[model samples]
Target chain A: MNWRGNALKFCDVAGLPALEPFVRLLAGEDVKEQLKGIAKFVVLPVAAVAVFLLLWSAAARTVVTDSMQLPSPTDTWTAGKELFAMHSAQRAEDLKVKQEKTMQAVTLLAQANSVTKQAESATGERKETLLANALVLKKKAVQAANYRPSSAPTFVDQIITSLKTVFVGFAIATLIAVPIGVLCGMSPWCNAALTPFIQIFKPVSPLAWLPLAFLIIVWAYSGTKPGENFFDKAFLISAITVSLCSLWPTLVNTTLGVASVDKDYMNVARVLKLSWSQQLFKIILPASLPLMFAGLRISLGVGWMVLIAADMLAQNPGLGKFVWDEFQNGSSQTYARIAFSVIIIGLIGLLLDRIMIFMRNLVSFGDPQAA
Target chain B: MSVAVLDRPRSKAIARPAPPDPLISMRAVCKGYGSGVTRNEVLSNINLNLRKGEFLAIVGFSGSGKTTLTKLLAGLEIPDSGEIVMDNEIIKGPSQERGIVFQNYSLLPWLTVRGNIALSVDRVFKHWSRGERRDHVEKFIEMVGLSHAVHRRPHELSGGMRQRVSLARTLAMKPNVLLLDEPLSALDALTRSVLQEEILKIWEEERQTCLLITNDVDEAILLADRIVPLNPGPNASLGPAFSVELERPRDKTALNHNETFKGLRNAVTNYLVAVRQKSRDDEALASEAPPIELPELQPRSLRVPRGRAG
Candidate 1:
């Protein structure tokens, strides 16, 4: 019974209420109701998706263009599989090349050792020539050992890059937004001061910020040569642009949350004689956390959306870049690949949203439906 | 002043000489909302004293600014005029010396029963070791008989239970004064009585200087050593103080049969009812104006008559 309750709670927190009926049924309570719940929550949604896919495939056959036709569901699936296969093949090829280089280096070193041994026994000119040959072999071995394979990023690699960029950008946004937001919420003076900037910049697009971010990052990295810089300039620009665009929701929400803490809670804080810092950490923060997390969820979502656009515009090595490149390629398979990428992007976005919801639920105190 | 003087309890006549100075005193305190013509006076020229270790209850009608009075006493609000003093120090703002149990049971919803109590206990006893703080919180939780629900959040608890947690939190603060702002008014009648007894029991044990703001007359009589009525508002003031001479461990069922309890209950109830009626009458007279006559009219149906049905 305890485990059943915990499982239901886990479902709620994970934003998977569809599984609740199964848990209840397993607990042996109201089988009929549970079945109805399962049908409504789980089976119905699956059926709807199936219907959607069928309609999409049927529509794909009728829609044609000079450049390419709309990709059918099967075409997109095949494209996705091919992309994954390409990624795996590239990885295997790279590994094989590295191994071949290592094997060559080993053979070269053995030759160098044999030459050095021969040189030790040789006389005069022959001895010098043998030593020189060993030196040449040793140099060749060194070159082979230092071999590095630099190739275009695979689909998986681009996906990883995109995830990394989004996370970093989201992190930067949270760090910057939360503190300033707290200040704005806690003090009317700060709020008044920041309101103009927030109002003006909040509606601005990530596209508008991209060039400016690129310029600033380029200037900052001017002293370091292109490949020598710690962070890739393109990556920084995209991330910074993402942070710039996504920070508003969190800032606004935090201010509202902090400013509108229940009057009763403030009274309690006063009565307790908690210090300003203590009041903030103990009373204000905890009280406002639900709203703050709500804001963060929005901010993260905005950041993810902005990051893809930034990546596309900035030509950063990410999923957005992959899509852009595929579009530019304009081959017979281009439409199918783009369709596959669209699904992947939507799925990733949904996953990110669910993760945010889970986090929001954790901080939402007793209000399970806060998000 | 005249009404208070006339309504003063006869118990004052038998007062002992050289009683200890009040632990807290409010002198000519006046508080109001708004300004100029629209100003609404919530409390006017209020004067009161709370002696150390005495349980005092202020009984008033809903919206008579009972909460405002409690807030003023708790130092959550400062009087617009006059002053509130504690031990010769002017009251300025809320402090740990004064703890309040809000009517809504203002328990931090995110925190469990132990965490709620521990928040106050930890702050008030900052010098105490972690174990000491934990034990102190546990003790207070035990005092309120909420040990079983120690890990439950306020939302998870019943209203009665939440109020109990609120009580424990305030008690754990070890405050010099406990201000209860109608803490049990929101509970059911059965829960109210049970809490009333629990409060009486705690008061007996702790003898802390406490002030309760409530509308329940019987509850005031049951818990308070002295009962003061806050007359209905837009300039509410304390009426006369009534002393309850009822014996300790006053049982709710048994108090019905006790002569002193019955007398005190009736007196407080009567006083509150009278003042409320008078205030209402005064408001009515002040706002009285000539009645406006309405034009006579009748609603006509949109449907055609039988003769014109074609």
Candidate 2:
């Protein structure tokens, strides 16, 4: 049948008087039912999460791995509780241990060229090393070592620290990336100048920056007069490394987003005699939102991943370091702690992604996807 | 409460005479592209004035620079070498005093119909309380007869509905001037007529100065008080303005019977034909000219590209 005839036929069926009233009555009731259905859809995920936990517990009883080192989920739960208690015992102690180890490693690597130099700097060194008078002097060695524990940071601490790093790095990246993207979108010269650089740097792996981060951080501390908090060096390094690594997605997405804003709206802005700033803020941002948010989401995810890698290498006092420490420690509880940490990491990543998506929906003006 | 409430646009509101100086005045405006060795003018020495509360339609052929002229009036682009003055100020950039509608509804896809309307209001009335923005947007949505679809997003709406939302958004801003860039061209005839009536009712009630860049002469006859014919370019300009002396609240059904309206439309048709001929002449004359030596005539196809449309 031709299109018009088909439309007429469909209308004939759909517009029946008896069906119309019935449909309307049903629809009114259906709306209530629909609300119920939506509530179920929302609740189902939570229920599914519970079911998965139950399954995991079941699997815990029946060992899933041959390695005695690897714990069942139940074992991980017990270990997790203990770790949490230990972390809560004294918050500063763990941080101090980690810091001292890193500092010891740095001090060993820096001034240990000769026994003469070591003796020369004996007064500056911590008292424990200088007290060992019976120690035999050997040829100068430049080796440095960090003491990584056999268990992860407690679940709560892991959650908190990982959350913080992701938040800090993601926030910094967002603050820097969005405006640069907007500038690139609005100005041809900026796009031209920046796109080449963005293309070049965006592909460089986050791991690639590890060497540079360590060098710069070490240099920065030594260059400063004295007595700077050692933790700041690690935090700053990881944050900057994550920020640089995570910057592209937000920037690229924002630029493309602003570029893709509808022409008619820009015309509307023009007709309103809006300032360039006003146009960017009022029109471009609102219009570019879906894409901009997409970029932000990706940037944050990348930041979270990069933070873990950076922490593991830099031995930053976060989930990243905790995970690495657990691996190196090789304790009987290591597997359980690692499992708990893995779950925490997944949850945190999910939570961070959700936060960005929420913001995206809020900013989005016309799209149903925003909902 | 009474004055503000009663200020709703309605029938029997007579249009007040425009202030002595035109609200927007365009004088000796010449715009060209491809400078130096490859220069060609798009609009040349074009002079016009937009009186307050006037519905002015500009009609022309495909390459006649109608959209260019509209963009200039709306402050979207600076002219190559001429000044466009709005009120007494030289147009520096976009402003809140004018609203524009495009042939393709430029409603942000991410926004709901109501949200799109709210965005324009939000920009202009940043100081307005949230409730005020809601109230103003609701009024325009009701005015455009889309109260049922306020929560519907742009992609969800049909083309006509999207255009209605776009109109609702624009009108909600209550600009002194409203520019329509062939807003009805993309719609089917039925939807076009429906929207035409809606837009006419809006103009009659609000009495804002409106400039419509259209190719439809009959539309010009029905809606515009003055219809200007754009002579096509390398160096196009408005030939003359024809005054539509038809009475207020002009009905579309009555348009065919109105001889004066017919005569005016005929004149516009004649002018447009002259424009088409002129463009052909120019294209033929410049056939061997450098390929780059031409004004980039704003692409006339309704679905223009994204971005600045720059």
Candidate 3:
């Protein structure tokens, strides 16, 4: 029962390159048809946006009083170009700052004279001048350390970082959620004792939790610090926050999935004298995959949003920070850039979801009639 | 030459009483659900024994608690009251010693035909190399004539093909006892008959202790060394056991003309008649037991339309 759809159809729908081999395969088999199914699923938001654009464009085609507030498609495109140019200039500024910082740090490290010696009035004014120069260089290095490229960060770069954070949080949540959920679902007592606590935490918003997380973590790790850099702290906070928010869906779904496993499979598990390992591997996991994936995908999306909000506040170096910085910049171009960023973020999120679905489909592909 | 195939096994059985003990023994068996407040006694005060290499058929109407009994034997559900001893020990849970083939063909929806079979084989024979499990499963798939669907998922498969995978999975396990809980009842007539023969052939080669639960009279008689009937559902008990006196290596094509085969068929048909009458009897008079007092089966007890002449 092969469930494979048309690859060509998927490609055509996705607007991917024809890629001769794929087209041929689709023609040769029903590969293109299956691919089309996948493409249709993924193109929903894109299609919606395209329709919105067409309508917006049709309206914008007229001057509509030629108001500056009414930024037309052409204006948006020009704005996009302007923002890109600004970012390019900003990126150059950032690189210069980084290069200067690196040179200062290297010079300081290689400096033959100690700061204390340089401060001594060995040559009167020359000594003062040397010490002042060192101090200024150190300050510049610190400032440069904070500087990042101003060029509009590519959507792909943001996606990578976004993916990293979401996956990290999701991974942490899965590690905690699946086992706990499976345990809770399998045992009523476990469910009773542990489940309510989860529900309590589940409903608590990431924004609400951020302050508490900040206070708790900074306080907890104030002493005996391990990697207390901004990036590390942001990663930790996002992961913990995500674990709190993302875990519930997976936990709830997994419990339901495990609880509702078909009795027939259970019977077969028994007859085979399946080891605990075997029972879980051959029956329980596969039976639960459909449901587990549902939870995972939900958790991932939630985590992605959570990371964005967390980053905006945390000033974590990612697209969320980009959005926050853009908003703070409060320039006309930055807002449009923000809008563009938002689109990119949504596209990345959509693609991330598709990847998980693709993995699941891989499992169900060979059996067209897989129950 | 054909007779020799059947002869080899019978001679071995006669020469060596084929191990002294019964393969599976039941003593004072009782199984039920709910408690004193809401108790439904499905099977009670039951005692039976199954010996090695015996093809035992359990016949009953739906809700006769035959499914429960099969489940108990398969180690799916624990016997609420009595003991089921396999290899001289009380069977508490499912073991590789027993393998169950479910009626609905419980193959994983995500797995291909080959993948489904290999999953069990791989899980049980964890030490076996991957290649070995693959080859082993593929051979059985070939045996069941499902080679074409080796990579197909469950939904892609026909009902008959899925059943074949179920058969293949259990056979690959090579358990000492094979439990069939109306395994072929869900299939079309043609598929059912063909699978029936496939099952018979597998049993012949493997010589495992087999217990089949079904409502079909012909199926029971055709596949069993002995047929055991359940009297009725919801407090139903085991009825008399009848030995199938048909000749060895029974030919399904030629068996209808044989007098002994006719006798066995007539006897199973009689049991079927009893089941139908019992169903009608249970139904015509509304169950005095309230819905709460009823087992799931008690509520939806199937009254299969058959001649109610006992």
Candidate 4:
């Protein structure tokens, strides 16, 4: 028996069949063949990427904007480094201020506690005075304890904020889409009821929904004082816009998936006298998961794309806003920074897609087994 | 035929007088598809009584509603105008009491060989402990000679192996009625015969009230005690039931030389041919009457492999 067979099988199932040659090479199958495989898979892709960079740099020289020239690969790299440095510096400054305030609060709290202990053993007037002094110190400590960094959000901060926003939007979309999708899939009446709306709204872009989302969110949070709630009105507006635009793919995919669950499986479930919920969870859900996850992957991609536009329009503190700010900043580094963000966004999208594929394969029966 | 025949080896039990009551009773069952002008009637007035521990086969040509009949009996489909009673209880919906093995080997693809069987076993024997359930599932898997494939998914298995998994899944449920919906029809001849023998062996051991649906006369003769021929459709009905006087542990190879087997096979085949000719004649006459352009209906004959049965 081949000892490397199990490792090869894992590579096959993990959608990394290209790695099988590497495994075989490591197992000492054939050096020449393994080198060829490595050249084809690994070396070729890297060479292609290098060629692409060369083309990009060449193109960058030819294309010139009104205020600035198109940033080259080197310029983008430099801008990226500067952004990282700025984030690090801001982070350090914030940390130092926060630490100082926390220290002050701790000292004040200690003073207040000592005063209260002394007041416990004192006479009436003196004790009352001491208690009053402790109360003032406690108030001061509370004030000092609320040490929020007042610095402008950095590039890294924008990325985190954008990720958080997209996640919130995607989660909301899932919550709204799945049950409705299931209902539509399972029942003709539900499908008929919802299809018209889905068709009409599915094509609407995030930009179109922005103003409406803003109005509704602003109205909803009209009474909410700023900094009181975690979700600021603008953040809600941007995220809701992302959800509205991104939800369609998941909804449509889920519906298709659920609707296409095998009749044979349904018969099996029925004959087994499985409960309705059991049928849904065990048979229906598992069968439909592959398509549902495919939808989710598409939805996430759409959500990420839509979030930038939403942030730019709504002026929410995310990568989109950062891009808009840089565009308005009109510095020599602005084009470079924008180019770097574009690459970053693309990489993030690719990563998300890979993650989704992994999730989908985990639950799928097989990768569409032919016969 | 009498109660004494039940006790005797290789006795014709189908000729026995209606004993006490059957395990299931289908009364004037009718089923159709579509509506109004487009509506096509499949089974008409299907009245069947399946006795306890009886091996019955329903033989029909393709589209003669044999599958529909099985589906009705399995409680997967409700009849248009009749009732199916099982153990004096009216059949309302599918239940764990009636287990079916479908032609397509309807093993859940996501599940391993053991998992497919375990799904049914767990459902039926909810009271059984986890260890007991696993043991029961493993027992059936081994019985089907699929112990090596216990961890393999359906797609990884061959057609024959997949069918075996489906069989194991149904049998592991230990249902009161075992329904085989042309289960071995999808398999190759060699695998078909092997599985047929395995099925015969399992039926002998379990003695579950079995219903085997097939298009093969030899298959019906090989396994079933009573063979019911379903007439060709538009509105198909049962032709008549023939009893096979075959013994338990019957050998297919030996049966090839047996006069009784020859007679039985010929009788069933002739009956099927007659029905086919009649249906063809009816179709010819109906089309001839209509001058208006109508698409000619292709007659589908029973796809019997020439050398295998004969």
Tens digit of per-residue lDDT, candidate 1, span A252-362? 999999999999999888888788999999999988888898899898889888888999999999988989999999998998999998899889989998888998888
Q: For candidate 2 chain A, which ten residues in a row score worst on lDDT?
A: A134-143
What does candidate 4's lDDT look like per residue over A1-371, in tens digits? 36687787666556665687899888988899899988988889899999999999999999996777989999999999999999999999999999999999999999999999999999989999999999999999999899799899999889988888999999999999988888888888899999999999999999999999988988888887998988977788889999999899999999999999999999999898789898998799888988898899889999999999999999989999999999999988999999999999888877877777667766776573111
Q: State, as a TM-score between 0 and 1, how close model 3 is to the true structure.
A: 0.75
Q: Against the unseen true structure, what C-alpha lDDT does each candidate score?
A: 0.89, 0.75, 0.74, 0.88
lDDT (10s digit) by residue, model 2, range A1-371: 35444443332333222223233334454566555554465466678888988887776667655655446667878888887788776456766776776676655544443444555566755444643431322211212244545455555666676667667777888899999999999887999998889999999887898779778878878867544564467777787789888999999999999888887777767665667887877788878887888898899889988999988887778888888888899888888888988877877787778777767655664342421
Better of 2 and 3 by DockQ: 3
TM-score of chain B of 4: 0.87
Q: Give me the overall lDDT of model 3.
A: 0.74
Task: For model 1, name the residue pairs that clash.
Answer: none
Which is the better candidate, 1 or 4, if ranked by TM-score?
A: 1
Error of 2 at B19 (Å): 14
DockQ score for model 4: 0.55
Better of 1 and 2 by TM-score: 1
lDDT of 3 by residue, A1-371 (tens): 12234554343333343343455554565676746754665466578878999886786565354222444566667766775676567667777877877776666544524664667745878877878876776665565555555555554445566667778778999999999888886778989898779878888889998887788767767775665454477667766776778888899989988888888777767666677887787788888776777788788878887888887876666778888887788665664577677766887788877666654445433322111
Best by lDDT: 1
Q: Each prediction's TM-score against the native?
A: 0.92, 0.62, 0.75, 0.87
List residue ranges in candidate 4 displaced over 4 A. Answer: A1-20, A27-40, A102-146, A368-371, B1-21, B45-47, B81-83, B88-92, B127-135, B147-149, B289-310
TM-score of chain B of each: 0.89, 0.83, 0.82, 0.87
Residue clash pairs of candidate 4: none
Q: Rank the candidates by TM-score, best first.
A: 1, 4, 3, 2
